[model samples]
Target: MSFASYHDNIELGDTVILYLSPTELEAITIKRGGVERNKFGDFPHANMIGKPFGSKIYAMNKRSWIMALYPTPELWTRALPHRTQIIYSTDISLVAMYLNLKPGSVVIESGTGSASLSHAIIRTVAPTGHLHTFEYHEQRAQLARQDFEAHGLSHLVTVRCRDACKEGFGLERVADAVFLDLPSPWDAVESATRALKGPGAKLCSFSPCLEQVQKTCTRLRALGYQDIITYVGLIRHLSFSHTKMQNFVIRPNPKGTNSNKRTAEQSEATDGDAQSVQPSAKRENIEAEDEETQASETAVVGNPGVKWAPIEFATEFMTGRPAPSVRHARPHGIFDLCDTPMLSYCFRGDGLIVQNDQ
Candidate 1:
């Protein structure tokens, strides 16, 4: 039943997750002479003992089978009996991330409702770290302690029955982070400040309403907590699939044929018979035609009777023009192109041709 460590074989008194389907799961403790009955069939606890943790065991009737799974925080969350409203895996992940939780992180949590998040927190800060959780309900606090003990995590967590919002965490400068999930989390902010180990320690409060968040934020600010940010826990599922669509082709209408006269139905009917060319092939053909056109147009012959200046390397290389001469040249200081002489600029090395406009 140890969720803090891994074991290969299912032993007596150990909790196992029975995976019936993707959406169906059950948690059962192995006890001698114990039997579990579901819509599938009867599963004997004796038959599961000594078997591998992941074995697929047949029902007593032998008509159905279910897989035995190693208990992890995630699987346990899915299978654990709900004593109250519990946090799901999505929000649990965000809590861990925002709190900067890791191994050896001392965490303080208030109002351990169903021990769902408690299990996840223990799993995160195991081996050397510890969790101090408080619950206002006395029965839930006792059940949480028992649950932790059954999972072999009693050494790593401390459970107390007390209202943290009123009594505080009852300690100071001990926790690396504090988490609050209470009706009036703002009331507990002062306690959280005392529990945290001074600066750099984080505090998170989970509230269902924006009004509660606002109050919490105000209290945190008044107490000198910095870098306060609010977050809403939301989970969105996206479905992906492969979709195939028909490729289309476009061709110019026949010369002298009025395209406007063609009805939408007629155009659509002709499209079915049009040649189907793959996009890649069409792109290749267009590129090849462009290369040929560029090669043919690159060679230029100067107009007759025009004195052409010797081509400069920069102008010839950049503009692909062989040579350019000043048109209607006047005195060096004057030009008829404009009232004031215009200074034409050109680049060095690889540059475009500079032309003096008339």
Candidate 2:
């Protein structure tokens, strides 16, 4: 199966993606007598041959079935065997976009582990461009080359076995963009600079540690590379469900209470002498107004018989539930850096101060 091109029906020796569920997908090569055994049942390869690329094939038991999907870069990422720690699609997209990859673009990639990002890059630059990928390990390089040949993408990518940090990419002024994934990327900054076409060419480095990024950026800046920045890609999950909350009702205060109070104040003022009654009447009127203001301000809904209000949040149309999470590294520490001589941290009312003696 050519990942760069699409076909209608499955052919022998073609890689097929068996989509068992949203979270479960497996890749298999179609052979004449090969059978895929899973919890569902045995899915014979003979039954899958000649079927449509996306046709659903039932197991031998005929109770459960799986979708026969054509292989794509995204699906391949999920289904590819993990030869090493490979880059995921989230980071792949960021790298591709930042490197400004396009058709006819020549790219240099180091340490092509598992060929996950390599497939995606090949698809983006197929039919016109080429990818020069280098791997330090010979076995990995050979396996990646075989996979590329099987996918009919050998013309679009070239796999080489070389440690880029010590040997460098060998080619100069040939790459439009370069990607580095190594233990010490700073050691290859000079070599990457020599490989770029000229000014405006881009370079991207993937490092898990902040110190690595720091050293890489320093080397890049010293080599005259501009606009050096580091970013972390994070995915947030929003929970959607129905929540029950209390409902309030507002009712008018009874008029009888206010009227009875006013009447008594008026009677008391009338019993006093006229001179004293004038001031008393004014004071009584002010007091009545104040009481009314206080009552209006304090009015609240205290009814316990209110029906529950069902508050529904935004619903996920794709999964019909919470968003699916991608594999990622969890943070090891909770801390923030401030521009000061000492470090200060406030976590849930606990304050910590560490002096930066360096």
Candidate 3:
């Protein structure tokens, strides 16, 4: 009795995260009574039954073993076959947050890329919610479609092969959010508005260049997409330098910190606690690198240690004749436009134009 496709336990046809080597891991679907052959050794799928989602699987000889885990969205991002350049999880997570993605969220994403972000987005809105994703390349779209089916995610995703910039998103005001990861995202700003839902529907564009951001922001303002903002989400990962410990075994953390559990025991002279306590280092040497980056974004616009050059535009783009005051953060600076209640952004004093009724 095997489950069709689920995330909790290993299923016969579900793709699992296979630890290929010390430095590499990939996604491979499990098959009943099937064998996986590699340099490490042969792994039998029949032996993986009833194991938890993240349990480790050993080789037949028990010498070379690998972790046979369920594919999480984060794991999927790292292990997916890169049909195109993909956005890492760090940026993807924050973007998901900025877009206010929850269960049952209907969103639009342009240029599926490796479908890295799409997988994450689909997971967030699974079971009921759906994602309408547009990809420029038909082959990439088809490949992504196949991947979704393999992961049992096709029910929550729609991969369309269309140029969102030229032909538009082809979706009405049904999107709770619109995320753009394109070369020229400015061309689709107008199209995104058509697909976005009612007031306060968040939108985000992922671009590597400041020029692209500026152009896209400009177009978004022109098209009445309010709360125009940007973001650069950076995530640091800690890497510990390892030494060769052949017999090293990682045990479950008992209860409390090592340092806190000691010394006071000598003062109190408690034998029961110290006897049961295990000998473990209080701290380990660590190093962190910012592996995630999202082009700086937010709705909380503020004067953060930068010279703001205000504009005196009169009736250029906005409807008001108060001469919309536009300000630019000087010298390649990034602006963070946060939420401002009672701040009329009708281009009077603020540079942003009012879009929705809110």
Candidate 4:
């Protein structure tokens, strides 16, 4: 069957926690039967499956309602069921985007925590693609395996208890994407680089600090990886309120509505004064100034032939940032002489040859 067809058949369930009294489960009668008994209460599995995800499954007798159809990541994070610290949805989404992960691509993930990210990866790379996740911790690995089996994704996921970085990526073949979420990602960079398909292969490292990013980027560059960029994702949930909106619109705060009004008044006053003067001459002068500025802005900044060189740098090498003095190291190798150098010298593939002096 096609990947799309497989995704359609998968029964994605919403996890709900029911807080019930002692008498609820006994009072309610249901069919496709099994009651998941927790410390708080017992939930009837039969009554939940057919209901829409996020629908509240109310146990009237027990005075409880189960929150249904929440996202899998959310459910896994809250109810780990087993002991494990899981990767949150924020990291998962970023990893998926930066790595360009999709169906049919082979992915290698290490330190599978609670299998939250593993489930997300499986969902993304289904049918044609497969994920080979390694976890050195025995307990975490077992729990992750169980979670995958429960989701019926065991066929697509290969869980192994091995030190992925130390033993090298266990695959006989290279992977399209490699995701490193371990504590020390720098240690695994060499192995990950070897497993990646050089230039086009995507590698992502998840760290909570800039220090880790600095170390990882340094290693990646030394290993001949190009175009390496690092950034953090911050997701802030703003509370939507009509009262706050009205206050922002009507309140005369200096930084908000008051400043906006002052700017508008100043613009109107300037327009009136300009109109009272020689309007035609002023307009012509302003147009001329704008044209001059546009011409200067559009001037060919660098050699039009070379592809990788920054355009503006050639015209005035020291305009924005000082252009590095291209000192020929060994007749072929180009070296830069600058405190803060630009990466224009490292040009590969077919592109316009951007000269330092045009």
Q: Indicate the residue-level lDDT of 203 in model 1.
A: 94
Candidate 3 least-lDDT 10 residues: 285-294
Q: Residues 40-62, candidate 2: write the lDDT tens digits.
A: 99999999999999999999999
- Candidate 1: lDDT of 216? 92
Which residue pairs show backbone clashes in model 1? none
Give me the displacement of residue 62 in model 3, in angstroms.
Answer: 2.5
Summarize candidate 3's per-residue lDDT along 93-181 as a digit string, tens digits: 88988888998999899999898999889888776789999998999999989888877788888999999989999888999999999
The local distance difference test score of model 2 is 0.78
Better model by lDDT: candidate 1 vs candidate 4: 1
Ranking by lDDT: 2, 1, 3, 4
Better of 1 and 3 by lDDT: 1
Clashes of each: 0, 0, 17, 8
lDDT score, candidate 2, position 5: 95
Better of 1 and 3 by TM-score: 1
Q: What tens-digit string does per-residue lDDT give for candidate 1 at 15-107? A: 999999989999988999999999999999989999998999999999999999999999988999999888889989999999999999999
Clashes of 1: 0
Q: Record all residue pairs in model 4 with backbone atoms less than 3 Å apart, i.e. clashing.
A: 54-68, 54-69, 305-352, 305-353, 306-352, 306-353, 306-354, 307-352
Q: TM-score of each candidate? A: 0.68, 0.69, 0.63, 0.58
lDDT of 4 by residue, 1-358 (tens): 1112222121224233232432222111123556655554566776566665445666535776654433344444444554556677777788899899898988989878777787788878887798989898888888878667655678888988978667767564468999988777888888887777666888888887788889989988998888898877778865533221111111111111111122233455675474455566555654554465454333322233423223333313323344344321111123233332121222223322334433
* Predictions in order: lDDT: 0.77, 0.78, 0.69, 0.59
Model 4 misplacement above 4 A: 1-42, 49-54, 60-64, 70-78, 242-358
For model 1, the superposed segments whose C-alpha errors exceed 4 Å read 238-358
Report the number of the highest-lDDT candidate: 2
